[model samples]
Target: MTVVVNENRNKRARVASATHVAGCRMDLNVRDFAPMAADEPALAGGTDEGPSPLEYVTAGLAACQLVTVTKIADAMGLDYTGLRVDAEADVKFRAAQGAMSPIPRFSAARLVVRMRSPEPPERLARLEELVEERCPVSNLFLDAGIAPEVVWAIETTG
Candidate 1:
């Protein structure tokens, strides 16, 4: 099948801003969307008002993968009934705290995609490949030397 290229893929600037609200807490705005907050757990000197910045990063990766998969599956004519994604990352607090450590802030990340589809495994595999290649957030992790391990669980009806 031939895939239609997006005409609006030209370069564009995206903007977001954050302001410190309190200890380890920040209020953020992105492109006129509803305001959001970020904060660390109480153990980290935060009131646990919202997810931490690291949590947002990990969640963004999962959400990006899900969106990329949906688009690629549509382009490939792959059928699916449901899709879910989970993401987690391992971070070295010492590095994030400005300690003298060789370890990167994020050491590793993993994404598990649970999909319910009737499509064949070969088709799904191709979709996975395209999603990994096209997902910007996943590429960010890879470029940072944190290779995210992506696992797909495709459930099919017998």
Candidate 2:
């Protein structure tokens, strides 16, 4: 796979393109993946065809965390039968609504990671720490002054 590097030395360049599809709706494509739609809610004059941009951002963070956790677990030889992640974010739309506000678009976010594993508590704690430290999307939230609350719930397995 080809990698593009931006001025930020530690970051890799990722590109996505969007096409406007009527009021508050857009068709977006990333890499070679299937096309996806992004739309605002009906209240925001959209058709509500797909998730809003903010929703996509929140889901991206959750997906990133899950990917990071799975990679780390495999590297650590941690065995798990199942894994799930639930994510939510608090958003302030004043800026998006054409108002100048000091508050950020995403005020905060929460993540609940549930895993069924035979690993010990210490091991699970270590996994959580590493995920928090390594997940790039999570770091993005932090860099934007939004500290995400991450909870790890591990169910011990035989």
Candidate 3:
């Protein structure tokens, strides 16, 4: 019976793994962005300037975790008025204060997940466990040893 229970737990619906790909061409006074995988090669700086593909990756990690947590809460029937996640990076650098690279930054991250569920502390605790377990972004941060903090704040409106 214990074996069956464990197997069933492992059988829960889950999706893991994805392929990220993109390509860029730089040919202007200032480099412009192009689709990583475009049907036709796009001209650089012709389109409106926007975030580089790398920025998209960083945002993806944050947003993916946020959406994953929300989905888990819904699937578990946990009641919550709303939820939001804010993420920022406290990056490393090319060198120390005066090394060399001039990369301006390596990268570190800070994330805050603000949850607005009215469930008792215990229930919220369970949801936290689920998000921690299932959120790819959160797991990535944990596995990578990036410091992330999630907190609850009383909801309010004006």
Candidate 4:
């Protein structure tokens, strides 16, 4: 099916995802896109075809942060050679499994951005501030009462 996107329509973006499940493993299909497999580990009775759902959430947070920082840096005239974001979350599964009430998504999360840049610490600090405010994924968690601890580590070079 050819989807005709109306340019005059609302600017909001939308994506559709469908999943085929068997046991603890499933293949996700996105519209006109490559299929991705997801599964739990052996302990959870899965073949581990790909990362678990929570893992994908963590990865998306990191990717969104990186992209936000990059765009902000470009606009702020900050020069950088390389950038990387390390992300981790305190994920608790018992809640989702009905074993625990008041299901917690992630108790906490941390994002550390490592960069090789010629810019000074102050500029990077400003960039970090903007990213925290602007990154949609990070804000999604924050608004849900899971404010992630953010860190900026830069190796300055000329």
Q: State residue 62's C-alpha deviation in candidate 3, in Å.
A: 2.4
- Give the best candidate by TM-score: 1
User: Candidate 3, residue 140: CA error in Å?
Assistant: 2.1
Clashing pairs in 1: none
State each model's CA lDDT, in order: 0.86, 0.86, 0.56, 0.82
TM-score of model 1 (CA atoms): 0.89
Per-residue lDDT value at 154 in model 1: 90
TM-score of 2: 0.86
Candidate 4: tens digits of C-alpha lDDT, residues 25-93: 887776777888888777667878789878888999999999988888888888997799999999774
- Model 1 superposed RMSD (Cα): 2.6
What TM-score does each of the candidates earn?
Answer: 0.89, 0.86, 0.57, 0.83
The full ranking of all candidates by TM-score, starting with the best, is 1, 2, 4, 3
Q: How well is each residue in 97-133 modelled by candidate 3, as lDDT tens digits?
A: 5654344342566566776666777766777676666
Global fold similarity of model 3 (TM-score): 0.57
lDDT of 1 by residue, 36-138 (tens): 9999899777999999898999999999999988888988988887799999999874434365534338989999999889888888888888888888899
Worst 10 residues of 2 by lDDT: 1-10
Residue 158 CA displacement from its true place in model 3, Å? 17
